[model samples]
Target: MPRVVVDVMPKPEILDPQGKAVLGALPRLGFSGVADVRQGKRFELEIEGELTEQVLGEVRQMAETLLSNPVIEDFTVSVETPVAPVPGAGA
Candidate 1:
């Protein structure tokens, strides 16, 4: 099986209250050198069948229509890379 990823983020012009809250808390929590922060969403779709252009297009459409709000946000779609199993994990 292959997995698809969709990342959605607020537009630069939009305000992100969650990201702001985290940014404000970071400094008080002993974190520094971070200038800014923007919050986003990631969606992973594990799908069956071969990875083809049509599948990619459908995923893109899903991102544009349902996964992300095109009005106040922008989205990026990609195929997720699979991780290899640990050499001795099963042992």
Candidate 2:
């Protein structure tokens, strides 16, 4: 089976309160070297077969219509890469 991943995030111009809160807490929590943070959403879709152009188109449509809001958010879609099986883990 194949899979697709959709990543949605607010536009850079938009203010991210949640991300700001986390950023403010980071220094107090003894964390440094991090300048900023932006929150985002990720969606993973399990596909039935090989990832085709048509499927990609449909996924893009889905992102445009339902997965993300075009006004304040931007989204990217990509096919998931398969992981190699571990060697000597099983028969």
lDDT of each: 0.91, 0.91
TM-score of each: 0.88, 0.87
| lDDT of each residue in 1-91, candidate 2, tens digit only | 7889999998999998888999999999999999999998999999888788999999999999999999999999988776676888773
Candidate 1: tens digits of C-alpha lDDT, residues 1-91:
7889999999999999989999999989999999999999999999788888999999999999999999999999988766676887872
How many clashing residue pairs appear in each of the predictions shown?
A: 0, 0
TM-score of 2: 0.87
